[model samples]
Target: MFALRMSLVILVADVWAKTPFMSEYEFSRRRDELIREEREYAGHLRELTADEKIVDNYLEYLKWQEFIATEDKFLPSVGLEGVLDDIVNSKVFKTLKKFPKGGNMHLHENHILSKKKMLDIVFASEDFEHLHVAVDVPESKKWRLDFFLNPPAGWEKVKGNPKYTKEKLLPHMTMMGSMTEFAKVNPTNSARRWEEMDPMFSRLGSKVIANVNIKFKYLESYLKAALEENVQYLEARSSISSRLYTLDPDPKYNSTGGKRYIDETGGEYELQENIKFIEGFVKKNPEFIGMRKIVNSYRGASVSEMYGDMEKAVRLYHKYPSYIGGFDMVGEEDKGNSLLYFMNDFMKMYDNTTGKSLVPFYLHNGETNWPDDLESSTNKKDPVGTLQNTYEAVLLGAKRVGHGLGFFKHPYLLNKLKEHQTAIEICPASNQLLGYVPDLRNHPANNFIRMGAPVILGADDPATFGYDHFTVDWYEAFMGWGLRLQDLRHLAINSLKYSTMPKEDINAAIKDKWEPAYQRFIADIKKEACAVDFDASTNAPAISRIAPREGPMKRSTKVYVFGRNFEEGICKGVRCKFGNAVVPGSYISGQHVSCNVSGLRRRNRKGAGKSKAVGVAVSVDGGATYISYDGQFTFVRNL
Candidate 1:
């Protein structure tokens, strides 16, 4: 019975010993896996370090991705719909929701009127004559009088009887095309027909020309619309060329006729009238900020003529410092003499004590994309050079630059502008419509903003373009430039910051009004976001990193390995074994930094064979960089 019991005991002991051996073998397999993973991770790190350019590119890509994701989260919730409705209807609109509209820098007085208003002005004018109907061969058919009646000494005369109304005039007018059919060959007197029809059509056509009286009426209505849309300021280009009430002698002298009508009326009277009207309206409703002057000389005028006009403008400024704000050379750039032609006169006017510049000068410098010859027909020697004239204007001390569309093409000038903190007024829709650039996205304004240029947004001529200031321009800028609410707010602040308004007033508006409004907007956005539930675990996947290992060796060597998590929280620890025991050191986690294994040493190596080494020690910290690896094997080091 004792011998049988001994044999059973021996059998049990042998089975127990075999169980430990199985465990060590499994542990050894795992150790091999961990070492392979470590080496692969080290290889990846080395590769990334060697190619910094690639890493930088990747980082930039990551930044853009983050920006896009952030925009996705924030943009949709902005009160765009509410803002639009408010722009259309609100009477007391002070802010443009989140948009920062700069100024109406490119408005021309003649184009501000509606088509209906223009038609009314033409039809209602008591200036159409119903005299003997005569047809001209080349230009126009006209109803001419035997002799033109001159007005009394003080009052200007009308072409027709003052009693003639729109109802009476519709039957007398004859429309013609292809000039040849319009002119009847007067067999009796060729010279008489030519002379009579020439002056007749000229007089009749003057009524239909862009009228400034209609423009003033249009502006009154438009300003109300703009105020509802929350437009803060306007600077319109006004000219004395066509609206002068006073008469001048015709340049072409005639022996028989003493004087004929010339369209030379000093715009000062009209300017003053407009100013008074605006001031009176603003007094009742303080939301309407006043207007600034941009005196424009026609480009078709001679150098002397332009200089004379400019001189007259200076006199106007001197006469009414508060009303006439600044001076500008206006008209088609191609038709006008180069601005350089009047540089001497400009300097004289600029330095004049009598007409000190109360308002800032903003030049419409380079509005062309064509070659110099293409820009001008009369002066074909390439007078204005390329669009680089904008830079020259800046050097000559223009406070603001208008239609600086060629900014990107001049890098040095761009850099100079950046250095000088000069702002560029971008009119995206106007530029596109006028054939400056094709698309809003490809507009150089985006490039300017990205390159850190001080940029302001403007509506060149919203009425002419068949759009409102807010909808077409502000909306396009928002969609095209990828601008966020904060960016928009900053743009608004910038507009006020660079405004010609007094510094004290700007500060009051910013501190007392805009800042609080912006804060409320941001708070509202955050409140809306917080009410929603977010499940990051379902939305975002976990990324893993391999734990690092270190050991004392004859020389520095790198190991590499690769692995992926097939399931959530699957990444665990590395294990090694020797004889009948299992050992563990390194570990990895999805959320935190992985453990480092350094100062690891193999014991019982030669006797047990390389594969059956006893045990290894590791430092969880980087060697020398964070921890020391002593000869004595220890898992923990005293910091």
Candidate 2:
């Protein structure tokens, strides 16, 4: 016992006595010098005004690091993971949580809610009369949430049916269902995994489209969430399946006594109604900027079909202009038909006039590992698919391309992207989830910024990965990717510069909004950095917490889907059945079906003095079974 006690004392002495490897005074002096150098580094860094959150982040990091270096007590070694965890939970993280994410040019419509809200807002609403879920069997069965215009006769039969219970739905709700769940991208076989991820995302988008009644409410909710996270702008991508736009139909006012949102009796509302709703929302909350909608022409579409979509998009863009901005090409790039496949036909209809192209495209290019995991043997024939897509997007004058991750593959591609000032919508979370980059530390974004190529951060499919707003995406890039404060400002500036907004508006926004915001940011930095170094002699500021970035510095995109059958390519003979209503020559092509709902007649106004209105149904397989769209059409007599 005496020997053991003596040994313990000797070990303690060994650690405390000579562990300094220098005199205690010298150690303290060197530490102070390092602190002074750090302060100097912070001062010299660019974009001081815009980097307040980053400054706060660095200060917090230094404070903890200083403690580790100066503390006399013995401490256990922490791994890199532990350090990252500390940063994730740090005050820096909270500050960054509210950093002004200038704009999210690339985003999916369905994934606005984080994990908790997905459970609460969506899955929890299963009790609603109109809400019904279909579990696609095979991959945990296909889980789809839909709204019923009128409760089908057998809806009650499946109410407690064991097959469609909450237990059945849970598998597709959380991380288990998110095919983009975190995992090391296997270089040898990421191809298969990425393919699986697509259907999962597609499935989610379709479900959300099917449940469009409360969409306006959700739009408000989504923007409110964006404001909380300090996102200034957003541009969401979704295909407008049909030209006919639908909102919550008032059942009682139409003819029905029940509260079926899509009941035919419910009167049809105009596209302008929803637009007005958004205009009011933005006017009410100055902090909430509006969202912009971009429609997609599914790449898998036929040449004529794509042209039809482009024509409709141009019409919408001309009519709404600001509300509906850009037309994009969306789908799995490698598997679907290439852009070149439609170029011959696409150019024929490019111009609004004889020779001028009015509708600009936002293409998705370079989102794949071309040589490594080709989607089809056909891709090998065009070995430069990624580069080709990038070129095509530029040639076609795309406003931006989402996930142009493979830009570095060709040296000239970077130069061209820079020349065009074409922004690459960087969705780190989405790309990582889909196995594009694998490790954020090695992300090509750093190179993109250094070379002055336009780059912006976005949350592609935020809901699919369980995120509430844009914050999760920006935060992940800020920390996980080792981006400093200055990098963040450059990104912010690029976002505004590359947006589809008018040049004059962009400049005014920068001068009026960005300038003032930056000034306030600098002031906040100065406030938190008053006592950074703690030497009795030095005047270094104390590293204190700073305030969160509050409200949008400017407006945001208030986007809502404009069409029905959001999925492109209406199958052959698929008909929208609305009970003998005069169909105004339906345009049937691919997934999109557009008919004039104005011809729809019901008992309320024209059809009868007293009769209940049911609803309209779409038959994908020529009436094998019927599915409902948002608004229903009824038969009225000849005018």
Candidate 3:
């Protein structure tokens, strides 16, 4: 049996080596094709510029083109696996990856998970001993050790009639049921069927408790993955609580309603522990250069609760000047209490006690465009209605704005943003995925840019979105905005320049580090431009060309005159004259013609040249006689 198993393994390895799955040749071919297509498109664009109308129309047409093209319908014949590989291997992607992006300004701490780690967490849980279940939930019927072995001394009464039976629990605990049966249950609510969940499974691993050890582990794993992708800095948003310890229905941490209560020290200690872990990581990995904090409030929290949390975050920022960078009001912006409702209180607190302006603000301004009435009544403001609140925040000195989709509606507010030079952190793909914008092309950042507003791209919860930094957010920015290479370079530089790093350090880094790197890239681009002939078609001379002759050419001159009565007249060649009709012989008048001369030759009379000439005066009043040339002449009868 052992020999047969070894033979089978060897056979499988041989098969895998010969298959396309193991080799990147297919991906490389697709990437080359895309580059070829881009070059062709560029050439076509050059030709189209001869007619500005066509170019404008085509650009307008591309406005609705979806960004990323990750869906199978938009994918190349090779499929998504190949498309991802091609993107990762492309020249543009390689160059962008090298850019020193300063900080991730919109990351959610809880959402940071990888597929491998998630599966490991689920599969490794000790509670699913005989069951093939991955998680513990009500529908999963998988009784954790706490529920079965140590059923909280009074659980029988509290839980209300515990129908505990091995047969009843076994089916719920196992994911061994057929696919048809699994399809009937909602995976979101059913822990055993997590594998069927699409986006959730794609981004994160199984849920873990919010304890010190779990958070630390998550951070380490998250940092490692981020580093692999060349992310140098992060500004993650998280809440401070002892929910994991209090999750157990013990009398010490839990009250009658199974709610977990946290003491002041407990919250502070947890935050301190996280800070220590971050510092230690930075020490170990010098490339992990920047870190900042963002305090988050749950959407369900009351106004007072939010104020208290914001105060805690402010205090932490004061305590750790270098680590805690800012305060953010997170959660579902469409459902939570509006920031405007609490602005007065926060202002008082900042003025009265904090003294330091608490922390710089980076608000999630508008993630939805639903009508104010349709939105949760408590929040009561959609994207457009929230414009006033955003403007007020800016007036109150917000450093940056997050997802300011409705800024376009208020031109004055947009002008304010431009005047202030505040940058909007746009997550185009995230907005599209969440249905805020149906497609990346419809995003308002395009208008923002056209109006000379500062904008930067971010991957908000990239892991949850089932996309990488390169393949998702950055890609969307490129395709959606139709941004040129220079625009992208500027955005990259802005990301670092506007980050929460200390002023001195930021200045030093920009001068000493990023400038050199940027120059190198510029030099490389120049070299490429020189090597490639951009105007090869125009290089050859035209066939029907005339040769130059070394000789002087003669010049000519001419003069002409026209009748006064005629509204329109044509004159050609040298020295010509015209006069109103009259029975007269030509007279010698030295290149001037009188209206009439009685004889062929007549002596010149004094002031005769100035006298009114007799001639027919054309008139539209039924051919009636009329004066012409300032009543100087009259028309004669035509018999």
Candidate 4:
């Protein structure tokens, strides 16, 4: 012990002799300089105003408290399905949702409406009684809805059927089943996920939304929902090949129950009528800006079939240049034929539309995790790997690349993408749910941004994932990637700037619509963030102690928080944090608030008992700041 003490004294003397101490002023100056550097790097895209910084700081605090500071991982780390309810209830997500998301450049036409919205549309239809659902079907074909004059065998009328109620039908239609549990059990079964998802469009699209009346209603609802989320414009990819029909028994030009074409003879009356309907919708809802369609051909289609789609797409673009935004091949890149497989068709289309700006290609490229050289002669159905698809997409002059998850793999291609100004449609939520990224923090798109690639947020297929708006995508991108307010603003701007909208229209959208909305959003965030002056000593809330401070693990225990200077009407933003698990605190009066303390699992450490003790705190400024109580609360395994 004496030798150890002598050694310690000698070490301390050597450290003191070698280390040069700085004055308090110099030390503080260096710290401030470091903060400035961080702020400069974060705000490289755009500078935040004073109020915007306040909002950013508050958001940052919430992100830390919700993710980093928490004992158990919550969101952006776990599977999206597991924390979906948490996301919905998040004040951070709710606030961010109100911010203007300029446009959704990569959504599919069939997935515009949520599962609930689909049910609502069907339930309110004139032919509601005629809607029949196939029961006793395979798991893949569960609850398939269709319109029939006479209900077929194994099919039952949904209007009066208790079993076919919307509540039950929703689970079948949506991809939100026990996926969280499934992911936990079988973590790498992305193929199974795709197997379940492949038929979703067919199940809903051909049977119900393919109906012209329902299609129109779906589009209308889409516009309303987009506006609700403050998304100004939409660019929807569509095959335009669903044999559209009407359920009406008495139709003017009735054939095959009033069937019609969306793209037959490019100049078909049905196509014109649909365009006219969209125009009317835009005229009425000017805030919507407008909608544009990107012609789609599944990558799994045969070469000849793909060529036909290419021809049809070209013809549509020629006939209705303004309405047709661009073209893209839609399907799983890893499971389908590569962009190189349809090179001839694309080259022909490229030659025809070389000088044209409207019919540009927005290809799905570099969407897989496989290495570039993973090829096989036997398995031509599924490409060995698809990261090399980036080469063909950029060479063909694709306007944007869908997913582009593997773009960063090839530094040359990444530079080319930047050179071509092709934006990457980084669908973080879709990527997470689909298993390309189990934890969003490790997504490659973060590197894509850091490397100066143009990145735009997209939801891919919101309906299939059981969500409606693009805000969740934005939320994932923001939180998962540690994005600043300026970074988000840059992304929103990129959504408009890289869109297929004409130069004048894009300017109008950014200057007239988005700019004003962004200003208002920042102002609103500031107002809410500064609602309570907790920083002021007179108004600062001080937690004293909690009654029944101990709770059993894996259960919730209601605890009364005794505090002073609690604001009146603190119901909106009051959060009582027990360790890292935050819950809503009910304000009873100036001195009393109650909250449920969740008994999260405790980690076993050397020399530590079964009980875990942590500080309890209260935050009224949307988690911007918290006042800790004087005592620690214990969570016990058996209480």
**Which lDDT values do the candidates have, in the order given?**
0.46, 0.55, 0.48, 0.74
Off by over 4 Å in 2: 1-90, 122-127, 136-141, 149-171, 174-190, 202-212, 242-271, 352-356, 372-387, 480-482, 514-518, 529-639
Regions of model 1 farther than 4 Å from truth: 1-102, 113-216, 241-265, 352-360, 371-378, 508-639
Ranking by lDDT: 4, 2, 3, 1
- Please, what are the lDDT tens digits per residue for candidate 1 over residues 1-639? 999999999999976764552332234345656766754532211222212222222222222333455354322122221233333332212223333243444565544433333335544533323122233423333432111223222222223545334343332331111112223232123233233323433323333342343335555765665555555556667675544221123535343122232334555556666788778766765644556667777655666776687778777767776566566766445445666666656665555665544335667766666543344335653356546466566666666677777767777787676667676777765565444554465777777666666677776655433334543455546555655443455566666565555678667656655565445544543343233232232233222322222222212112111232211211122332212333333223222223222322445232332222123222212221111112222122111
Across residues 293-376, which tens digit of lDDT does each residue of candidate 4 receive? 888989778889998888888778777877887788887777788878777777666554455433678887887767799742
Name the regions of candidate 3 deviating beyond 4 angstroms: 1-95, 118-209, 242-264, 352-356, 371-388, 468-471, 516-639
Instruction: Please write out the lDDT profile of model 3 over residues 1-639, one tens digit for every residue.
Output: 999999999999986775563223234334546666765532312222212222222222222223223434432222122244555654555545654454555676755554345334433444222112223344322232221223333323112223533333322222221123433332122222223223242112222334322446667877766666556567667676544322335565334233243435746666676678878987887666656767666644666787787777778778877767777777556556666666654675556554546667777775656533344334443222433556555766667778888677667877788788777888765565444554456678877765667776666665544444533456556655666544555566666666767788777656665566555545554444334332231222111110110101111111111222111100100111113323221111112222221221123223334332332232211222332332222111110
Better of 3 and 4 by lDDT: 4
Candidate 1 lowest-lDDT run of ten:
620-629
How many steric overlaps are in each model, in order?
13, 25, 1, 0
| Error in Å for residue 26 of model 3 | 50
C-alpha RMSD by candidate, in order = 22.0, 30.5, 26.4, 13.7
Each prediction's TM-score against the native?
A: 0.52, 0.64, 0.56, 0.75
Q: What's the distance in Å from true for residue 359, model 1?
A: 7.2
- The residue pairs found clashing in candidate 3 are 118-205
User: Residue 588 of candidate 1: its Cα lDDT?
Assistant: 31
Prediction 2 global C-alpha lDDT: 0.55
